[model samples]
Target: MFRQLKKAATFAAAVLATTTLVSTAQAADYPEKAITLVVPYGAGGASDLAGRALAETARNYTNEQPVVVVNKTGNGGMNGARYVTEQKPDGYTLLLSRVGMALYPAVYTDSPVAWDDYTFLGILESTPMILAVNANSDIKTVDELLAKIKSSNGATTYAASGPTAIDGFTVQALLADADLDPLSASTLVPYKGGSALAAALLGGHVDFLAIAAGSLMPHIEAGKMRALMVYAPKRMDALPDVPTAKELGYNLAGQVDGWSALFAPKDLPEDVVAKWKDILSNVATNDQWLDLAKKRGSVSVVGDQDPAAFVKSQYELYNGMAKKFGYIQ
Candidate 1:
């Protein structure tokens, strides 16, 4: 009886030990080295602002050294995306990408990557752009601006981030609805970033600018820039008086994917993915994250609730918009 009991005890101990090993092996084996996060756009852009915030806060969740941001930019963010998709499926490498990730492929026929080849961690925040003019300008509302542009007939100029930017497209979409050339009512002035465009608005270098909500808040409070319209469905607290684009006479409607999220190689171990999701989810709801988001001029949303739903919705959204706009052939 003693020999039988001893054998049973040893077998039970072996099974428990095996279970422990299996559970911890992947957790330990993963991220054994520094992780490199690739930001698709050049530094100082909206993508960089959100990416840096994530890198700064991700360390708390990663419970290790912060992930390093590697800028691999070109072809409006396609160059770095191609590189990230081709990288090894280790959790150590990630891509801090934008909505353009999905939209670009749908819009540009020659884009080199596909959606199924990668994994999404989740979104960090959502920002809406506004059409802003100097506080001293005569265009006080969306109606006034539209009237002026239509009367001016391509004489009025507005600033945008770049050629294929959401701001640019928003302008295009609005114009298309009004039966005017996206570039017809206004000349599209190019600037390096939202900040630069905002600066131009303040300095009176341009007639108006299409800039993000947070980026324009300070100026709005100081009465430097007047908001004509916002892209969001409802009014934002900072600028309640500004009407949404849909509220204007035009039927223009949109919510560009101005969010930042986590991305891992498609083949990362499931345990690692779960660990990251858990870590990020905790950080998203934490006070530090909320404060950081406020400072950055964005709303706090993360993990399953925000990004997961947005990702699935946006996959449909961008594809549908791209097809509707003829941006895609």
Candidate 2:
């Protein structure tokens, strides 16, 4: 009986050793195929553009496998976000998500995806929200837009992808700053996605739009839309003519910035997380990435701070802003 017990113990030890070795080898051999980045919104939107740009520049640091972006739009970004949580946590499938993920709790009382359900890699880039109107519209300046909102008295309209979206939140905050009744001073038109919002704006369904600056660069350059003011500390190089809210003497605060980050399924291997952080850290400093972001009218923000902390702060910030604007309890 003693001999049998000793033999069993030996077998158990061997199995444990072999398991550790296999895990180590797997970590070393990770990312053998293409990495898929799931953007929760449709193509041509700000998130899609930033995800594509990051994937394109990630090849410079990736181990030869290309990073592909897939758009699974719906449910105000919850659909695509939840889809990634169901995928394998092998660092192969990642979510290039937005501020909406952090704002979910404040916006949705029963959210399907928790902020802690994913491992946040880091914030990749951010673009200030742009307040724009169709080029042919008589309202061309921020003051004019405000006057229209005040004079129209719940008649003048603005389009946003959704009530919980960053753009929508910006519109709400803008009204709050101007001391205008959000519900009465203007009608907030909601759409399913940025593409739809763009259509509504261009087709004259809404008087104006508040969206990521990068998303409207093409339209503005094509003479289809006119940018009034950006919600940033200063004007962007790409859109140098557009003044900031501060420059225009309107303080919309820091809550209007739009950002995108990378996330993986929860319980990702430590080594895999570290690998991604390193890869993305490199991508943040890459000149090509910066130039691409500039061309897209976005700015690259790669801070050395822990990503988890950054995400937490953003969640808190958005939650506070939502409560202030009466978006949630």
Candidate 1, residues 144-216, lDDT tens digits: the string is: 7778889986888888876457667667667766777665668888887667888888988888877677678
Model 2 lDDT per residue over 141-241, tens place: 87888988888868988898666678877787778788986555788888766667777899999999888877687898899998888887578887888
Compute the lDDT of residue 59 as modeled in candidate 1.
77
Q: Report every candidate's CA lDDT.
A: 0.74, 0.82
| Candidate 2 clash pair list | none
TM-scores of all candidate predictions against the true structure? 0.84, 0.89
lDDT score, residue 9, model 1? 100
Q: Best candidate per lDDT, number?
A: 2
| Candidate 2 local distance difference test against the native | 0.82
